[model samples]
Target: MAKSFQNFSILTSIVTLSVLMFSQGMLDTAHAEEYDFVAGIHNEVTFHFRNGIETVNFPVFSTTSDIVSNIGSSFEVEGVVGNNPYLHKALDEAYLYRMSTLSGGNSFEYNYRYFDVDVNIVQNENVLKSFKYDNCEISGYSVSTLTDDYESYLASDTGFAIVNNIQFRCGGVGINLDSDKSSLNSESRSFTDYGPLPFKLAEDVRTFLTFEFDHGSEKIESVIFTLTSGFSEANDAGPSFQIITAVLPHPLIDNAIDKSQKVSGMASTFNEDFDVSVEFTNSQETLRGLDFQDCIVSGYDILTLRDKEEGYTGKRGFATAEILDVTCSGLAPVNPAFDKLSDAKESRSSQMSNTYTTNSYNMGTGPHVIATFDFDSGTEVVDFPEFYQGNMIARANPTFTLVGVPGSTPLLYHVVDNTQGSGPKSTGVSSNVELFDVNLVLAYGNDVVRGFDYTKCRVVDYIVRTEHDADESFYKGFALTDEFYFECQGYEPFNPKYDELFETSHAKTESSSSWKEKQRDAWGPGFR
Candidate 1:
């Protein structure tokens, strides 16, 4: 049976066709010349919308000179029009959005749709190559309209359509058309696979159309859009669809005023990882880090809606960052963390083996204790500054009496003793206005354990007490001693330039050796 068609007529006012033709020839075109431009005649196109609705329509294409040869009839398939229709409307909308960039609108809105188109290359009666552009969209487009009057005989509206990402598959069967084929074989065999996936036809596949109208009826007489193949290669394959699963870490998105997200104002194809950084409005840092582990970023902006009572607020501003493909792993808590208070108690108990109470006297073997502070006038103190353990006596419960020396015109008037009670919160003490250094000293048989030379110091806390108040039996019959506790600082370590005041004292008396021997005997053989 011989199938034939001639002088096909396109009925609809608007139509879209995707063509990715090759110049080098598909299989073997050594003996074949250039393929003449031919028309693709599909009975209908089915459009799939965002709301899941489907519509089948016959999109018009001028075909007065589109004559199908008997030999080329073998390329025709026996089926309904392809399920995916060329996205003509989507492409037009995308192009208009691109044009809007000139006026600072900076917004594009569209729902992605799928469509299929075919490209045929013919030389006289023989069709050299045929391909199907499946799941393709107009990634790019431009228009130029011309009206010419030559002797007032005829007028025309002509335009050229530059399309991209039109996948071309040979024999019209599967995706990844050139994957199994070699580079040389793929290049010479596939139509547009040589570029990027969703291969685009750059040079020879552009469509040119002209509108013809009848002046008497003021109506369009015919529409002609041609797909020309300059060469025929039998191995030439067509376009295909790639199934991509959304990966993470994904892109950074902004919460619009309406809380919608966006990627681009027009069509976008991300072949490589996009690296972008953004800072929030009124943020201190130039770029803030984001954690988008698993997100399917909405690639387009969500347009505002309107009702009679509530009007649309329009699109809000937003920032965009690239979607990254990465893996995510869980982290465990930190092990063997340190606690300062607990560690201090343990250390003191382990080394000293004894504790002291407030105002109690103990004469035994212990870590050497002596310290000194020098401060300049005008220094203010609020709370006790933690002293370095090596520079101070690290005892379980220890206190030192603070004595005020006269020449400096004392900022403090009492002698403070070590105690375990919560001391009075002293209004900060400020040193005398005159710049002079006041010396503080702790003596142990004329030897100092360590000296801390502070540039300034003050009494941050002061507590006064009578001996009877602390230990009732110790002080009887109105003969009682008063004790004070003071905490202070507003000072920093001063320069110890050849200063002997900072040297630790290691002087020992006869009593010290006796105490050491007693400690060793008390601990039995376990003492080291």
Candidate 2:
């Protein structure tokens, strides 16, 4: 069997304004506004080799040239148009232009120009070799124009790809001879010259092959896998079997497939004895799911959980010490004065008298006269006595005198009931009769004469009289005719007594005799 030969290669290059800094006579441009760069593979190809024959699976030289042109135009338009204005300005000012190309065989180059200055970047190739069975190969590559554009290109196309070839050669196929004196020419009868022949030798085998470039072109910024080979049965069964799972960090394979049979329900089942089950409780401690035990009640007081006394079910929980009944003494007795007046006791005589009277008398006929007199009744002299008693006898139309009568004299008097017909009543006059019933003698002599007609009396001695009586008598002698008359005499002197006395006695009197002297001592004068 013929050997299978598969080759793959990848390349990448990145350029930036920093590269222009190293060029001679390439002064950094400060404010160039716009710039352009190109990034595309110049030639990329993939071939399948069988028996030393190569068939182009993906040919970039002729068929894929449009793809390269489109890529280059895309980079020039997108990278330049979207770049920072200052960076574009610097590039344009420096006349900076860059180009990058990548081929299928991990071949790449970066060419930069700033005016007359030029720079080249390259990445060396990474190759894999095998000699056991037919060799199979695959490769990936990429190329970047500007540093910024490189990132964009990788993000878009990721990386490059190279096709693989499958081929076989029969073992033990040596020189052969034909019959009938015809000889088979070894050179003339090539491998294809005869019909299909089969031969076998070693065990079935497989391997991975890749070609990568590291041409020292601004370093290999990153290597990414854009394509990968398919999986095989051997990969599923191998101890370290790997399948292409992810791409960014080169490639990845998970152990899930390699260890699938070791899972539950499979022949090489996973260990069920090692499995554990857990349960969560409302307590601080944990217990195994299969175990049962009483939990320790944290933060619970045992004393609070038990009754205070045995069989004491009054309160289910705890209680403090019982408080004995308390009694207090030493309170002072309240005064009866402060107590509310009861209905029975409240009827007692009032402490403050309500009726008020003055000593002055009225002279006008129909006017009221409050006559006041002092009396010597053999006990103490009553200054302003509350009651007076007397019996009065009529001496019709009698006249009396008022002068020089001492106020101490007593006389018999009566309150005549003027409301009756013509004469005194049989029941006699009561002491409580009105004062007008007693005809007050304006003045009186020594005569004991009395009656409502005392308006006539004149006597040898002056006299004044008021009514008085004994406790049981209907009428009694009150004071001497002297006392009442004396009061009357005093009042008659000042007929309009109230006003005249008040002015004379209450006025601010002056010691001076003459009218001039009195006027001189008036309020505004020097005497003031």
Best by TM-score: 1
Which digits, one per residue and each the tens of the lDDT, describe model 2 over residues 1-528? 122222211111123443333221133221111111011111111112221121111111111111111121000101112212322233343232222222222233212111110111111221111011112221112222322234334544232222111111211111111111122222232111111112110111111111111211010110001111011111111111111110111110011111221242345444211111112111232211111111110110000011111112111111111011111111111112112222223566322111222223333333232222221111111122222222223333222322211121121111111111122224433233222211332222222222222211211111121222211011111121222221111112222334554674545765447667666667575555
**Can you write out model 1's per-residue Cα lDDT over 65-103, one digit (the tens) per residue?**
101111111112111122322243455555666555345
Cα-based lDDT for every prediction: 0.23, 0.19
Candidate 1: segments with Cα more than 4 A from true spot: 1-442, 469-528
| Residue ranges of candidate 2 with Cα displaced over 4 Å | 1-366, 378-494, 497-528
State which candidate has the highest lDDT. Answer: 1
> How far is 82's C-alpha from truth in model 2 (Å)?
99
lDDT of 1: 0.23
Please list the Cα RMSD from the true structure of every candidate, rounded to 1 decimal place.
34.0, 58.8
